[model samples]
Target: MKKTVTALIGLSLLVSCGNKNQAPLFADVALADEKQTSDWLAYGRTHNERRYSPATDINTNNVADLKVDWFIELPNDVGLVSTPLVVNGVMYFTGTMNIIRAVDATNGSLIWEYDPKVVEEVKGKRKIGWAHSRGISFYEGRIFAATWDGRLIAIDAGTGAEIWSVRTYDMERSLYITGAPKAFKGKVLIGNGGTENGPTRGWVTAYEADTGEEAWKFYIVPGNPADGFENAAMEMAAETWTGDWWKHGGGGNAWHGFTYDAELDMLYIGTGNGSPWNQKIRSPGGGDNLFLSCIVALNPDTGEYVWHYQTTPGDTWDYTSNMDIILADLNIEGEERKAILHAPKNGFFYVIDRKTGKLISAEPYVETTWASHIDMKTGRPVEVEGSRYEDGPADITPSPWGAHNWQAMSYNPQTGLVYIPTHHLSTNFSDEGIDLENWQAREFTGGLGVRRKFSDKQPREYSASLQAWDPVKQEVAWYLPQETFWNAGTLTTAGNLVFQGRSDGKFLAYEASTGEILWEFDAGLGISAPPITYTINGRQYISLLVGFGGGFAGLGADAAELGWSYGIHSRRLISFSLEGSAEMAALPPPYFPEPLNDPNFTINDEMAARGAIVYTSCGVCHGSGLIAGGMAPDLRASALVLNKEAFSSIVRDGILAGRGMPGQPEITERELEDLRHYVRQRAMETSTSDRTGSTNNPRKEVESH
Candidate 1:
């Protein structure tokens, strides 16, 4: 086996040597193994998804000397949350609308830009997902990017020209791509997210790098049994589910958390939650629900499922395992084992055997009330009484926003610790008056069978933290509390430093071992993306995207309090180095939109009540109560909302589709009027005094069904 692997590697090198311009297949394998560290070649720096750099030029002692090396403003972009990849002196990243840009690594200068033209491609059919792509992928001299409209296109690494394009799914469905495409072994993999939008049976597809031809696809959840299974794995998964789950789509979308192990020759993907989130509606006779919220290992060459470890079995609280799957070697009980460290939404920090998919240890990284603990004997979480909200409404800790979301965490083998960007928010889960037996999924809107409410009265202790946890000991080594519940991801280095950005526009670095603050920089905008470090011309530089907007950023007032109002701050890609000196333009102070109201307009209660339901579709990007959380416009403060003709032009006629406000062409005339009434109602209710402390208030009484 060793000789065969060596011969294959040697042949690949010879082929690459024969053609100097062509990149060899699996050229990033060395970086994945930490043998190459000068460039960041993969989404998580390497295929291990560790997000740790071995470069030590910017160590703890010198990180304080770091200043602005170069910065570029993205004038026409929003939600800049992608990790910029640096390969061979060029930097590549995806911004709003899945627009790919290439720049010089030595100096931030545009080399080329490729716009997917997502708004034009979808033709105003998609209104929810537009500007929230996490990243793009690079492999074999080609850059792979998945568009918001479900098209995966491979571009030439040097010219930014489209090489080939393939549509991953039908456009009529509510599905969208927000996660980065994972490229490995000459194949690029992409997944879509829309668990609560409609009937979505989640799956991940792998395509050939050179061509857009489909290689293989592995469905995260099984389809209808009467239609027969795609393979033996889907048939085996069907037995763990009850009722006609296929009708509801049995969601297990692998939107994130994809890691490839070159040594073991395996692919690992973390599956998402159930379609409706309520087991009573999706799986009447409660079963484990097989693959939902699970980490499944597969044969990458064939997309064949090998083994899986379910994290939140029969997941009822939107506890998705689609967070981060980091592979590391740990010493456990005098034995070295290949382990997968996972801190999923359920609030448990898990260590599982990556090779065999066996549980090693599980502990809560935050306050978790849904499950008391994980039972090692059965490798399942021991649920608390009435925690499922079956008996009544249950207040649970670690809300659906998750203790940890898609924000990447970094695992440093040198420090033997995983630095996690964690939160402590909780939610009140209830199904109070819903007809569970007759429930049906809704299209392009939140169809969650359960209703979740956040309490403004909750203590501030339920905030966020940057925790340095020892994976081997299964305990926190050190932690630093954060002011806001949502922040960016972490990056660790062999220089004993950890870097992270905050929602308050501050990028900071801390001592990896003790969590001591080392350096800080004011980025001038909220950052929801991880930082990456790379070296060119023997000089090291750190780059981060400065803009915040994701699932949590759209969660009404809690996120609005940050004051990263839409169009108020500039989104930028900023880089820093020890020897650099560049002055950044001072940004305007944080501005909060004052709700505009008209004394002459009379309130229509009936229309407003109906509009609240239609607002769910808009709330995914705009805030829940018409508040703007830096992602989109706050309709309550917009003059356009008061004018019927102007509003119709922007919303119904797709006039502003080019600006990221996708027009809802399917909405009727009456529905549009109702929406206007609802926005006006919210504006009238929020006076000057109410705006001070109302951002964290509970959502309006209208259920998000």
Candidate 2:
């Protein structure tokens, strides 16, 4: 077996050496579809989005012998969540700031690098370039990256020279690319993120692979009817909308998780949540917004819509279908059905007939509070009223984190099961108008109100689980739950093993049939990317991107509730193989800046309550509760907060917006005074505790979720 693999690799290298252009590196979609183990060609390994590997060299029996082969440290502090692609012994993925890196798959050695140079203009207290790019794609002798700065760039695969580039979105708008770029047939496809932060609309565009020319673009939501419809689909979708949705940008961004079916010649796009999240605000008449929270099928030749199945019609909870989608042929009711499997944010696992857009089965995979079930006949969810926060505040389980996020799930053909990274967290939803001043307080969650101040009433501590699901039976085969939430995506191979990383800093593999953990490595940092297996010179290896920060960073207060240390010191690309020994560099401990002592301040409970509300927006940049989760400074220890006059100047006036502190236009003199009182009190308490060697506040300890 070793000799055969070596000879095949040698022959391929000789063929490549005969003619050394980018032609030898081209990844044909059809050829990649049948591939199981030799190489990882596409994002999902195969165009079907199975995320399954056929490598058996590192089986469950010998997986314990696997050691770190090599590691590459990334340069940016932003999270690294890209599922890397390897072809012909070459590895490629995107780091923070959408910087692309090409590495030798066998050893962790950098070959070439390309920085998108995402311009970072500070918007008040926030910098612009912190967003991430999930991964990149190889096609037509070129490498493609959908950058956070809203550009689709193609680079020479062999060399790191820029081939051609095109701006995909308006710089003025918040839309940027974070999902992996995909290439199929003769075109490359990319999507954007940012609808959650602004009145953004979502659209997916396809470009000519050879040239950076726009081939076709598909808008998720209908635009102004006056502008005329882009196609018949828009005309049909417009009828389901009742208000001036176009003004709100009617989101439905195909932000992440797209799959392609070569056999059906169909492109499956999972649309995102609505812009204003609250449907009543965006569309007062309350019609089922077409395309939003839906898995729509489109024709790859043209950007024409074929069929769609909406998961959450009138979506008000950010229940996006933008989670990963897997295609499989399952036997059900005595027949083999071609189906698309989806476990979206809505907390339901759906099996739809991919050809005609019919719902074969839709069942809740988690403890879903908003909907009881989906009616098979109508294919609509039986929503629980008040779940939309129509009458009052309603608590929804599985929160906006969904039962799952963009973390890629894997479907193993051998085990006939899918492994998913799932979370158990809930949020209290309220339908109330946020004060215009505080509108910016929360990252554009459609001006919706959510409170995670669990304080006694919130559910038990949030948790994460690796669930092995039986897709055909629509049931969970086994589950391994953890105390920590926000675990990484899964990768399953023919070796009866499943691999995933944890937010609490561990990379693990579990027995495929049972839930017993087979092996684990203390990564010492969070990972959001899925694991992938590939071979170079007859050696099968595993690799995944690691770093901890992304959407959850901007999710207000308790956003850090899920095990992130807030320390953003390291980003690494880790690879492992049987008995391979490589040492990873040590990680710096979490930042604990010294607190400024304030001997003159008095604690005021009322002032603290008022200040708490004011601090919500600040927590987006600084960690939760002014306790540094490692992104920014621990305000409780800042000298800026120690001085009352300086605090007032920076807080009340736009004095340091360029320095990333947007002044509070919503706070009056009295409110400013109250905020000063609160920060002073917290700072004093922290300083005293540090000096006296007392334990941290229980509330703050729990913030690490």
Candidate 3:
């Protein structure tokens, strides 16, 4: 097998030798085939989502010497969430604003940039509808990426120009792409992520690599007509769902991560939570919603459903199985078998046999109070009824973000350990008394719910934790606690190091073997993107984009509700390495508004209580009057009323495009006035404590380029 692989690599290198422009040396691991050199050829390395690299030049001992090599500043203040792909001495990545760039890996010089310009129809709505392009895919000299607003584009890897483009879905319906596309076997598979407050079904589609033609699509949730699949599989799927799930678009959105196992000829995809979130709405009858919230294994060539293991049956706690499904071989009951491993949002590390979807073992990787334990015999989660949010203000652990959120978690094959960046924090999640449809528009109504802060409720001993799990033993080996939260993904190196960016703005590297701190750099802002490593010339460089923004970065609905400084004016793409490196380039000035203290308004405790009642009407979408969800701004620290014009326009006209803040006619003028007053008071309270003095605004700070 090794000889065959070596021969293939050699043949590939010979073919590339004729190309004069190609770099003489590519990836750190020189194979017989040079075509595979230097570049991250597939998503998660080779589509199995292993995220493992053969490059060992920067391993354990030398990793400590890793320092700043060369850094390039993007001209725009676009959000940078892309996990860069390095191939043939060039780095390819995307930004939050949906621009793709190809840079010379050796010196951080711009090779080319492709701007998708996912511009909104208007500024306000743009802020609201803006979608992020996390990363892109490469196949046969072309790069593929799904746009924030529903377009699948293929670009020339060398030139960074659009080679062919196809619309993935309709943007008007609120479908967008925030995840990277996976290219395998001459086909491009992509998923749509926008299931926000809007009504949309999640689906995975494959297109012909060369022609840009969609070949086949598998809806994560069953469709209204249900025409595509074989009658047997479709019939089996239909049996699991009750009611007109077609109306609710059958809620399961597989927007996050997926992996393909070539050995098995199967593709494993993580399915998200059902729509309307409230189980009462999705499956009123309550049976295992077969495909929703599960790891589905399918045939890549035919899009045939092979088998599925439901992760969360009738998933009620907003627990979606749509976490990254990594494939690995593990021992179960003394027998080694190929298995699929996952650290789902429900806070459990699940191991299932890949040959046949059967549970091998399951255990909690983080502190979760939601379920008593996973019934290994039945592979079902035994939930404590009181732990669930049935309706009318219930405290649900893990919140909607899950115990381990969507930041990428890396599994190191060398150490046989899975490193996860997790949040030990918990929140009280409630289902506003309203039903599904009404919940969509008037979702934030305050009277519908309340939340008790659990962080302070627990002793200082309890907080966020980063854990390393031994999948073979089905147990946690070690854990490191953070003062706050670690929402970023984990990146493991062969050097026995694990790198992760924290919510508090520290980019840390820990000893992968013992969970001890090796080194940490203050990126000066919270990180939302994953860290990646590659060899440019002879040096191994580590790079990560740091900026404070994203749903986890305290973003609220509408620009006005978010704090400006935290908006990440310098969310620049930064690359670094060791000694005598390229001189650091000067950064552009930071953009911050002068701090201003608004005149205090005397609203007694009684008035605050009265305003709280009024807030019930506005909270329908803003989230229990606190503005918690990323879809909308947090009202507790809102600055809407700080600027009267901005406040009134949103209240009266509504900034539907940007913040998802809708204007309600049912709100009486008196109620609006009271709501405005309540917001002003909240702003004042936030200002006094924030110390930055700048009003919380969620939009990006324009760079003075």
Candidate 2 is scored at a TM of 0.85
lDDT of 2 by residue, 456-494 (tens): 333444456789999888899998767665567888988
| Per-model TM values vs. the true structure | 0.95, 0.85, 0.80
Model 1 RMSD in Å is: 6.1
Task: Compute the lDDT of residue 166 as modeled in candidate 1.
Answer: 97
Q: Give the lowest summed-lDDT range of ten residues in model 3.
A: 1-10
Regarding TM-score, does 2 or 3 come out ahead? 2
Specify the highest-lDDT model's number.
Answer: 1
Worst 10 residues of 1 by lDDT: 1-10
Better of 1 and 3 by TM-score: 1
- RMSD list, candidates in order: 6.1, 6.2, 8.3
* Candidate 3 per-residue lDDT over residues 217-313, each given as its tens digit: 8877665654554445567777787876666666677777777777677788888877656556666787787677899888888787899888778
Q: What is the lDDT for 588 in model 3?
A: 34
User: What local lDDT does model 2 show for residue 581?
Assistant: 77
Off by over 4 Å in 2: 1-17, 21-23, 120-129, 432-446, 449-462, 553-569, 585-594, 598-618, 631-705
CA lDDT scores, all candidates in order: 0.84, 0.73, 0.62
User: Cα deviation in Å at residue 286, candidate 1?
Assistant: 0.4
How far out, in Å, is residue 512 in model 2?
0.9
The residue-by-residue lDDT of candidate 1 on 582-622, one tens digit each, is: 88887788888998878877879999999887787788678
